[model samples]
Target: MSKRREIETLEIEKIVEKLCLKSNIILRADVLRALKKVCKNETKNPVAKKMLQLLVDNAKIAEKEKIAICQDTGLVTVFIEMGDKVIIRGGNIVDAVNKGVKEAYQKGYFRKSIVIDPIYRVNTGTNTPCIVHLDVVKGNKCKIIVMPKGFGSENKGRISMMNPTSSIETIEQFCVETVKIAGPDACPPYVIGIGLGGTMDFAALLSKRALLRPINLYNSSKHIAKMEKSLEKKINDLKIGIMGLGGISTVLGVNIETASTHIAGLPVAVSISCHALRSASAEI
Candidate 1:
C-alpha cells in the first residue's frame, strides 16, 4: 500500500454498502457474548430468561444466513479518524461513502430504510448518503468505524443541560430514568453510554462515540469508571428484564466518558445500544 494512498471513490462506495449489509445482518460476537454474560448474571425471572434465549437464537440465524435481524437497516453512521498526512485520491469522499452504501444495500439484499425528504416521506430505497463524521488526527492513515444506529434505540437517546450546581446524583437518576422510560422499546440487555460536559449535540455525539469503545474495557479515568459502575447497578435495579419481560437485567453495562465544560452549565447525554450492538472498524 502506498503511503500516499489513492483510495478510489468507487472503493469507498463499495465498502460502505458492504459494511451496511454486514452490520445489519450479523450481530457482532462481542455484543452477543456481553448480552449472554449480563443476562446470565443479572436476570432472575424465568420468562425473561426464555425470551433472552430466543434473542440469542435469532442472532445465530441472522449470522449464519447473512440476513438482517431487523427490517429497519438503520441510519448509516461512520466515524472517521483521518491521519494528517493522508490525502484521499479519486472521487469525492462523501460520494464515495454514499456509493458504497448504495452498492452494499443492493448487493447484500438488505432493506433500504432511508427517506428522500423528511416531510414528503419518499423512500430512497438504496440507503444512500450515510451520516459520516470525520476527525483529523496526527498520523498518516485513516481509521473508519461503522455503527448502524437503529431507530429503536436511537429514538430513545436523551440529552439535558443542568445547572453547574447539579449533582452527580441527579445525572445518575437521569441515566436510570432514561432506561425506564425506554422500557422494552429500545431492546434490553443493552449497553448504556453516557457523556458529560459538552454542548447538546456534541455531548450526544460523545455518548454515542463512547459506545464504540470495547465492552470489556473499563474507562481509563478512575472517577469515570466508578460512576459507570454505580450507574450500572442502579439501572439494573429497574428490573426491565430481558426484552422488557420484567426481570433483573435492565441494562448490560454503563460506560461513561466526560470532558471539561463551562462553569455555568453541566450537559449530559445518554445513548443506548440494543443487544446486537453491530459495529466494525478498520484502519488503512
Candidate 2:
C-alpha cells in the first residue's frame, strides 16, 4: 500500500497567505512582458500608447513599493490540485484557505470585496468563504494557485449556448461582440479567455481557468492555437483601445480551453481580465 503523505492545515494556510499577498503585489512576469510589447506596438493610437505606458509604469511602482497593484484587490479564488495519496490533517482544507485569505487581506491591506449575502449586500469584513476549486489527481504533491479577481473585468464575462454545428466563424463573432459590448466597463487591453464545449457551468469554469494560464503560452492543439490567434486579432480590430479609448492595443492575449460536450449543445464562455492579471502558484 502506498503511504499517506500528511499535509497540515497550518502549512496550507501559510502558503495561501503568502500566495495571496504576493499575487496582489507582484504582476506576473509574462503579463508584464506582454504589456511592454503592447506599448511598443500601440503607436497608431497615441492615447492607447500613453495608457499602456502608464499601466506598465504602475506595475513597476507596485512591485517596487510592494503594494497592491489595484485598489480593488478583489475576492480571492483558490485552485487546488490534490494528490490521491495526500491526507490533509489537523484541520479542514476550506477553513485553512479562508483563514489564509482573511489574514492576507488584513496584513496586505487589500479591500474586503465579498458580501455575506447576495441580496442583503452586507460586507463580510474578513473576506471569508473564498471561492475554491479542487481537482484530485494522481500524485504525491499538492499544488495551489491563487487568483485575486477584480469585478471590473469579471462582470463583463458572458456565456452562451450554441448549436453543436455552429461554425468557427460563429464562435469568433460571438467573442468579438462580447468584447464590443464590454467596451470600457470590462477594461480594455484585456486578456480574453474562451471556453468552448462542456456544460454551461463547466464552460464558465473552464474560461476562468484559462485566464490562469501564462500569457505567452498557447493551447497545445494546433487548431485551438490558431483559433486563439485569430480571436486575438478580431478582438483587437474592435478598436476598443486601452481603457476603451479607441486604439489598436485592445487585447493583450487570447486563450481558449475546450472539453468534450454533448452532441446537442456547444456552450461558450468568455472571461475577461484586466491588465493587472494577478495570480500566483505554489507546489507542496
Candidate 3:
C-alpha cells in the first residue's frame, strides 16, 4: 500500500504567491538564453541586433532590481498537477490560490489587470480569481506552474476547425498567418505555440500549455518534430525581426502539442507569446 500525505492549503498559497512574483519579475531561463544566443549571432541588421540586446539587458535589470519585466504584469494562470494520495486541509484549494495571487500582486507592486466584467471593464483590483487548471496524478506531491500571460500576444491567438484531411501546407499556412497578423503589436521574436488534434476549446488550452514547454525542446514524434522545425523555419523567414524591424530571427521557437481527436474534426489553435515568456514552477 502507498502512503498518503496531508498538506495545508496555506502552504499551497505561500508557494503560489512566491511563484507569482518570480514569474512576473524573472524571465524564464530558456527564454533568456535564446535571446542572448540570437543576439550574439543575429544578422548584421543594426536595428534587429540593437533590439535583441535591449531585450536581453532589460531582463537582467528586472531580475536584479526585483521589478516587473513588463508593465502588463499579465493575467495569472496556474496549472496544478495534484496527487490523488494527497489530502488538502485548512481551506479550499481554489480560495487558497486566489489569496496567494492577491497577496503577490499587492506585495510585488505588480499591476492588477483582471476586470470584473468584459462589458463593465472594471478592474478586479486583486487580480484574484486567477485561471486554474488542475489535474489529479498518481503521487503525493502537487506540482504547480504559474504563467503570467500578457494580453498583447493573447489577443492575437487564432483557432480553426478544419477538415481532418487538411494537408501539412494548409496547417502551416494557418499557423504562419497568425504570426503575420500579430505583426509588431503582439511583440516579435515570439514563441509560437501550436495545438493540433482536439476539440475547439481543448485545442486552445493545449496551445497555452505548449508555451510552457522549453524553447529548444521539440515534439517527440519524428513526423511532428519535422513539422515543428519546418514551421519554425517558415516563421523566421518572415523576417519580422525583433519587434518587426525585419530580420531573420523573428521567432525563438515553435512548439506543437497534440491530442487524440474525432475523425471529422481537426481543430488547430495558434498561441503567440512574446519575448518575455514568463513562467515559474515548483513541486510541493
Best by lDDT: 3
Candidate 3 per-residue lDDT, tens place, 174-254, comes to 999999899888888899999998899999999999999998999999998998999999999888888778877689999
Candidate 1 lDDT over 155-273, as tens digits, reads 99898898889888998998888988998888887889888987888888889888888776779999889889898888877877776777766776787778888989999999998
Better of 2 and 3 by TM-score: 3
Question: What is the total number of backbone clashes in candidate 1?
Answer: 4
Residue 21 CA error for candidate 2 (Å)? Answer: 0.5
The lDDT per prediction is 0.80, 0.91, 0.92
Q: Per-prediction TM-score, please?
A: 0.93, 0.97, 0.98
Candidate 3 has which clashing residue pairs, if any? none
Q: Give the TM-score of candidate 1.
A: 0.93
Please write out the lDDT profile of model 2 over residues 84-149, one tens digit for every residue: 999999989999999999999999888999999999999989977799999998877799999999
For each predicted model, how many residue pairs clash, with residues at least 3 apart or on different chains? Answer: 4, 0, 0
**Predicted structure with the largest TM-score when compared to the true one:** 3
TM-score, cand. 2: 0.97
From the highest lDDT down, the ranking of the candidates is: 3, 2, 1
TM-score, ranked from best to worst: 3, 2, 1
